[model samples]
Target: MPVSSENKNGPYKPQPIKKVSTTTVVNPGFFAYTNLTGCQPYYCAEQVHLINNITVTALTIIIRVQKTSAATYHGVANNFWTGYINSNHTDNGSQIIYTFVLDPTQTVVASTTWYVEAQMDLYGTSQVTSADTYTVSVTGGGITNSYSGHF
Candidate 1:
């Protein structure tokens, strides 16, 4: 995805495009960043949008989470830190689960979207003083997508 315009916020703004390459055109609902909500300045959960681009059939999607920064932080499950897909979709806590099963054997169709939320507490001595960068990546259906932000 490329930002094609500018706003008061600055450059690199996310824009909608129908063509990705000379041979390929974007699908009807393959939009990713339309629902993206970027990072907060401090002490807040950050969200990023994930989309399924494969239209052949429903496939299981998994998001691998990673966090790094010059600062340090501590994450305690069910406390200051938590990760989950949005309420409209099903999810599991221990592992990244984009549970789209309407029934036992069914999964969400392609072009469906989900948002992953992650938050943590700055417990280390340098955590509050430095910046923390969180990155998430997902690979499935021969396509890989990733996003990163600071908090």
Candidate 2:
């Protein structure tokens, strides 16, 4: 039997846009010397800027590391070490784009920075080291828009 229009619920729900950021560091004892014995940390955060209208479901972060020096030691170390990303934010069934660990063989001259982007299934809202800044990009509904900001 057909139901009355008044008994029907609202329209289908859509996913929200999410904000994300990334950072990089070159500590004195960490990723600076030959021992390759130090550590660097990455951070990502998300919040609901709007009301209870939207909810976030997934997020992904992408980081890129570039070496400035062509020195043999630096080149060798770059391939030897790995990079990684750490976040306290809970996952809502989203896949992480990429994560890398720091390389210890790279020289001090090497310049490194991380680029992070996130996607949320439900309108949500929104760091750095080694003299670097965080760049954030949000993607979702509402004309399929995109925005970039620094922090």
The residue-by-residue lDDT of candidate 1 on 1-151, one tens digit each, is 2222332234533333223244433343333331212233433333334455553222222222223422122221111012222222222332222221122233334655454444433233222312423343333344434333433
Instruction: Kindly report which residue stretches of model 2 are placed more than 4 angstroms away from their true locations once superposed.
Output: 1-54, 57-60, 69-137, 140-143, 149-151
Q: Please provide, for model 2 over 32-149, each residue's C-alpha lDDT reduced to its tens digit, 9 standing for 90 to 100.
A: 1011111122223211111112121111222221111110111111221134323322222322222222222322122332222222221121112122122222222221122122
TM-score, predicted candidate 1 vs. hidden true structure = 0.33
Off by over 4 Å in 1: 1-42, 55-108, 122-131, 144-151
Measured with C-alpha atoms, the lDDT of residue 69 in candidate 1 is: 26
Q: What is the Å distance of residue 80 in model 1 from its true position?
A: 21
User: How close to the true structure is residue 26 of candidate 2, measured as C-alpha lDDT?
Assistant: 15
